[model samples]
Target: MDTGTHLVIGLGLAGLAYIDPVVAADPMVSTAVLIGTVAGSQAPDADTLLRLKGNAAYIKNHRGLSHSLPALVLWTALISGILWLVFPALPMWHITMWVFIAVAFHVFTDLFNAYGTQALRPISERWVSWNIIHIFDPVIFSSHVLAIFIWSVHLMRPEILFPILYAFLALYYIWRSWTHYRLESGLRPRDPTYEPGDRYTLIPTVHLHQWQIVKRKQDGSFQLGELRNRKINWIDRVSCAVHPAVEASKAHPNIACFLYFSSYACAELKEHAWGYEVRWADVRYRHRKQYPFVAVLLLDKKLNPIDSYVGWVSDSRLEKKLRMGGA
Candidate 1:
């Protein structure tokens, strides 16, 4: 989920806290809980500040350790303690409980998106992405906005409205999961030639009827396509064999970091007038017939990295940047 969705859900959690009679009776406690919830919601993502160091550091660490099991406990305790100091009259237990809920909810929701969090870190570093929801879902965001508006207008009580809204959202998640399962099952390749390493990954788009699909083969090739109204529209196939240039480029920091972050990474090696260009891309996200998340490395004839970049850039801009000698 995006920051806006997380914040709105945090506010929704605060509203739901009013179900407790003690919180409902005290205005100061309610205000204190609101602050705790909102802050707790955004705490895990504090790792976003790593961008100050560079994209490599940011890519390697964002949502890696910060969204782990240990981080969740730390965020809850730190946020609750800070709020408790500001509102000495409120019960510390109440503050801790709500803050814990808000922090846990943030990690849980992130598991459904394509760029999932390392929520199971310490136990396992593997990324757990259900691939059932987009990073930003209009339905989830707008529902929270509408519910907040209704609460603001005093059309319904917070305690009553939020519980109902959350129940509907829960059902919505289940429905989305079922839809993904059905689509994946229908697309599963039954050919005996399909190697054990071959697999299909379905990534949801903003539109419910549309999804991005990646078929990764054992040979390090990828078939990118789109699923619309139960039909698969094949888009692009990236078939690149192992090459010395591609192997050498992986030693560069930018390319290494991009490989670590990308699940369906593919590399293309091209000989140029100056040297060689090794283009690595994550095939999971395809927009406007372009794979924007990429890492490009220019290597000399001797396979030394001259210059490199690792970030999101459109195909056209990437070409311009390469032509300008990594400007």
Candidate 2:
């Protein structure tokens, strides 16, 4: 989830039962306590995508442990242990109890979002990411943004209104997910040639409002289809990887960066005349390194052309250093 989006979620979860005078004064309650505690618990996942120093090992190892129950227990023990040893008089148990809850809540919310989160990692090797919501759904983001503004204005004042409003939003998603399912079920039967070993996908529904359907065909090709209001498959191939190759042929080092985030990346070269432009991202997070992008380009030493790239992140200093050093 985006940081801002997560922040709103974190605050809400932490303060859920602590808003009114009955809960506000308790060390275990209140918006301020909730925000910080939630941030700590949810903050670890951000590093899994190569944040901070941006090392691949950081990217690879971050989610494996941070989202686990053991990690939370250990975190709680350490906090309680330190507080008990240093400030024995403080309400240390409450601190530890709330800390553990905040951590668990963080992992729980991530489990429902699109980015693969390392939930149950040590105990379960499977990664988790809900395709039900877009990484940035306007409805989701706008709701959170609006909540943050309202809450910030009150400055953690004890009020029941925010919680009530948020409760309704939760129900809205339930209904939204229902519509998304209906939209998918209404689509035409998928041609199985692109599926894995003739196996069918649940026909993953992503970007709820956008209503994108990505399913594997019987032929092992991944087809990105749309079903928000209608069914449409614009790109059909073994994978989107080929599009990156086509994109590389017409890309410079800059658009190469663009390819990192383009949803429709393609690569190709011409005999001295070449062209490359993102055909899809005019509406989404353009120039943000991820979203509706089009074909990428690649060129060789003689500016001839070379292989295309796939499955890599752009703008990571650590990746840059590693590649340069490796080269």
| lDDT for 117 (candidate 1) | 82
Clash number for candidate 2 = 35
Model 2 misplaced stretches (Cα beyond 4 Å): 17-23, 26-32, 46-55, 76-90, 155-159, 188-208, 239-327
Candidate 1: lDDT over CA atoms?
0.86
* Worst 10-residue lDDT window, candidate 2: 276-285
Q: Which residue pairs in candidate 1 collide? A: none
Candidate 1, residues 122-166, lDDT tens digits: the string is 999888889999999999999999999999999999989999999
The backbone clash count of each candidate, in order, is: 0, 35
Positional deviation of residue 195's Cα in model 2 after best superposition, in angstroms: 9.2
Which candidate leads in TM-score? Answer: 1
lDDT of 2 by residue, 203-275 (tens): 2233444555555444434445444445455443333233443443434443443333332333323332242
Candidate closest to the true structure, highest lDDT:
1
